[model samples]
Target: MAKIMDRLLLLVYSIIGFAVSVVALLLVSRIIPEREAEDWVESLYGTDRLLQGIVITVSVIILLISLRFLYVALRRGNASSPSIDQRTEFGDIRISVETVENLALKAAAKQRGVKDLRARIRIVESGLDIMLRTVVDGETSLPLVTEEIQRAVKEHVEEITGIPVSSVSVFVANIVQTQTFKSRVE
Candidate 1:
């Protein structure tokens, strides 16, 4: 909900900024008359209490939005990537999701018949849920290969990271075809 609101605000802020910039450019370049700009401001200044209140409210909202943009831009790099955080006796241990994905890929690739491999890691309440998408050689048994991949990935990640694995899901995306090339004679 907060992310959605932030995105919506960003979109609104961008549109307003773009419109204001274009208007300023037009005024400076004499495409729009200086008198017209002054007249618009004067009209707003002479408006009723409701109109004045709305103008003030919009100004405050724009100011707040600009400040938010600055804050997000100047924040530290630690918040950039999601990590699995554990509170240890020593202190805290942080493992990046990318690191876990790489571990899963490493373990799965060591198994026979895997032609290509890709991994995704999701941090759940219980532990990590790993998803592996792979392409295997056509000659290999799918069930056996997938099971080995699941077990290997689960054990390897758990042993290395000390984080309990909720599940390992293996998806066989494709099978590599065995192609024979014909000898060419001159």
Candidate 2:
């Protein structure tokens, strides 16, 4: 919602600036006499008169307004509709790897079979890759538990964050025993 408002504001500003510039240009052109073009130029440049001041002020204002419109349009274009080259930033803007890893860890921990989870993130040539190591209960079926954990984590991470997860490698490092000795004996 806020983003839409910002884009709308930029568009309005750009339109206003462009309209002002066009109006100023038209007004200036109308004020200049047709037959005395050369004399007007010579007098304006040669003598610092009122007409010269008006022309200078209008020209400066038009130039500034045009530049402002161009800048706003460029900025809004980059934000709302970005090109292929503008999609990826050169330095420190790669957030997919970290975001995917964090989401994966959180998802895996929430699964029924998963007792604990450890996730590792790696950035490859293709995209973001995630490796999750999950500990399950000893009573849980190994294959089924691992598969469920993988599916749950992958779905959650991909749905929440717009990052594509290349791979989810689930390693069952150990099985956790929640039953106490007394409970077992009883």
lDDT of each: 0.91, 0.70
Residue pairs whose backbone atoms clash in candidate 2: none
Model 2: residues with Cα > 4 Å off, grouped in runs: 1-96, 180-186
Best by TM-score: 1
* Residue-by-residue lDDT tens digits, candidate 2, 16-79: 6787688568657876455566676688888768988888886776576567657756874534
Any idea what lDDT model 1 has?
0.91
- Alpha carbon deviation, residue 26, candidate 1 (Å): 5.4
Clashing pairs in 1: none
The numbered model that scores best in lDDT is 1
Candidate 1 per-residue lDDT, tens place, 70-97, comes to: 8878978676578999998999988999
Give the lowest summed-lDDT range of ten residues in model 2: 78-87
